[model samples]
Target: MIPWVHIDTGTIPNGGGTLRLMRRGQEFSIQLGQNELMNSRLSGSEVALAELACGRIAARSGARVLIGGLGMGFTLRAALQTLPERALVEVAELVPSVAAWARGPLAEVFGGILDDPRVRLLQTDVAAPIGAARAVYDAILLDVDNGPDGLTHPGNDRLYDHGGLGLARRALRPGGVLAVWSAHPDAAFTRRLRDAGFTVEEVPVRANGRRGGARHRIWLAARPDGAR
Candidate 1:
């Protein structure tokens, strides 16, 4: 077995917790306490989060996207691949070290996606942009925490709550999509999406793409075009 090595440790902002970077040969992992937040090898669902959301807005010109959480940059890379050159992707990351780790120890995994011209990296809470906007983004991709049932920050719960869902709906342009990734499914959260006036679709995906791994859930909630 290739022994795992501890590379760096980061403190999550607002008392979220500590994030540790561990490496086993070429494979890297970001862990919160004992729980693994993300692994370099398992990026299928993360890729899908961007693919599915960007696919929905493929026809939009100069599409703008807001991606919450820059974990490993899988979603960001995938989004860049799917969107056109004119598209702009704003990545909000509350923990600054995660971004540093991407450029530092995890540079190879990130593949220089952060340096892309379309990417705008923001070291602030995603909610700030979401709250400050009014029908601004074409798509909002959230792979934050462990989905609605977050593990790192207590404030993350607001991002999944009814009020938060309403904020997300308002932040999105008409027919814009809000995609969320989760380690598990929450039926109530599904209900919350519908209650927030979004057309929701719950998708089950593999963690390692087609090869198979853990089954995860992704919620694709679309705001109606006629909605104000």
Candidate 2:
């Protein structure tokens, strides 16, 4: 049996604890304590997060997307694959070390997507970009924390709350979609989305691509054209 080798560790932003990177041959992982945050082997839910949201906005030309996390770059890469060439992506990663990991140990997984002309990587809280936007983006996908529970960063809880949902609504164009990735489902968060004037859909997806793995959740919320 091959033992997992610890490669490195990075501190999570906002006093969110530390993430340890581990490798065992072809597989890689980022973990917080004993719990795994993300893995190179299981990217189905992350990819679904991008594919589902982008598919909703496929008709829009030059669509703009904002991804709230850079976890192993799976969501970003999946988005890049799904979106049209004219589309653009802005990835907001709160932890500086996570970005460094992406460019460093995880570079092969990221595959130079950071250098893509269509991308602008921002090392800041997701809220910074969301607050600055006003009907400017076609889609906003948040794969932060452990979803509505806010496991990594305590501050991430606000992203699923009413105020955060409100800002997301304002940031998106008419009929724009807001996608959220979670390790599990939250009924309260789903209710909050509707309260924020978004028509929500909670989807169940596999962790690994079309195969065996734990089920994850994705919330697809769309702002109607006439939504205020």
Candidate 3:
């Protein structure tokens, strides 16, 4: 067995805690403290996050997407694959080092997706773009902070709260989708999505997809057409 190597470490902005990058041969992992946030070998759910959301808006001409986290570029790469040539994707990553890791230690895992013509990487909190936009995005895909129940950043809770859901609803174009990836299910959060006026679907997927791994949940919340 190849022993894991500690490649690098980065501090999360706004006192979010520290992230450690680890590798064992070709396998890579990004972790916060004892919790592993992402791994190269387990990209199935992350891929689903993009495929499921992009599938919802595939018919929209020149679709625009906002991805809340840039971990390993699984969702971005999947989104680029699923979206049309004219589509544009904006990826917001709050931690600077995560972006750097994508370019540096995890470059092979990212496969140069950062330089894609449709990709625009924003090194800031995803909330900044969500709050600034109005019916701007065709889809907003959030794989941030272990879903609504965050572990690394306390501030990430706002993205799952009532007001945060409201902002997301406003930022999305009518009929657009807000897809969120979670390590676990939150029935209350599902209720919140309904209360926020979104047509919600809770999907249970394996971390490793068909091969089977830990069960995870993805919420596909669609902003109804003509919704304010």
Candidate 4:
């Protein structure tokens, strides 16, 4: 087995803990404390989530999209491929080192994406972008933390709550979609989407693509044209 090399490191939330970026062969992973948070190899969910989020909106000639996480750049790359030439994607990633790894060690997989004119990388918490956007996006795709029950960062739990869902609803354009990727099911979180005045639909897509294997749920919520 090849040895894993440390690419870089950063702390999550005021240095609450450290996140180590490690590489083995062509794959990369983000580890928090001792657990592997996310990796590039098993990125099926990222692609599915991005596809589900973009959906028909991506077919629109000039749609604007917001992607909450940039892990592996699978979601961004998928979106870039599906969307039209004039589409725009704003990627909000909290960890700067993750971005660094994307450009450096993991460059072969994610580097070219950074140079795409359609993409804008924002090094900030996903919440900030959601809060600040004023009904400006056609779709918002979130895969920041593990799931509704956040394991890496407790702060991310709010994203699955009514408050965060409400903000997401407000940030989206009329009939715009808000797609969330989860590692597993969260019934209560689905209810929260309804409570926030979104027409919700739960879809299961494989981690590897539509071809086969264990499935994961993707919550697609849409804000009503007259909600606000």
Top-scoring candidate (lDDT): 1
Assess candidate 1 and give its TM-score to the true structure.
Answer: 0.99
What lDDT tens digits, residue by residue, belong to model 2 across residues 1-228? 899999998888668898899999988998888889899999999999999999999778999999998989999988988988899999999888889998898899999999988899998999899998989999999987767867778888778788989999999999999999998888989999999999999999999969869989999999999777
How do the residues 100-208 of candidate 3 rate in per-residue lDDT, one tens digit apiece? 9888888888889999999999999999999999999999999987878667788888999999999999999999999999999999999999999999999999999
TM-scores of all candidate predictions against the true structure:
0.99, 0.97, 0.98, 0.92
**Candidate that beats the other on lDDT, 1 or 4, i.e. the better one:** 1
**Model 1: per-residue Cα lDDT at residue 10:** 95
By summed lDDT, the worst window of 10 consecutive residues in model 1 runs over 145-154
In model 1, the Cα lDDT at residue 51 comes to: 93
Q: Give me the overall lDDT of model 2.
A: 0.91
* Candidates by lDDT, descending order: 1, 3, 2, 4
For model 4, how does the per-residue alpha-carbon lDDT over 108-225 read when each residue is reduced to its tens digit? 8785988999999998888898999888899999987667765656777778788888889989988899998887888998888999999999988777675665577788998887
| Candidates 2 and 4, the one with greater TM-score | 2
Clashes of 4: 1
Write the number of the candidate with greater TM-score, choosing between 1 and 2.
1
Cα lDDT of model 1 by residue, 1-228, tens digit: 999999999999888889999999999999998899999999999999999999999779999999999999999999999999999999999998998998999999988899899999999999999999999999999988787866787888889999999999999999999999999999999999999999999999999999999999999999999898
- Output the TM-score of candidate 2: 0.97
CA RMSD per model (angstroms): 0.6, 1.1, 0.7, 1.8
The lDDT of model 4 is 0.83
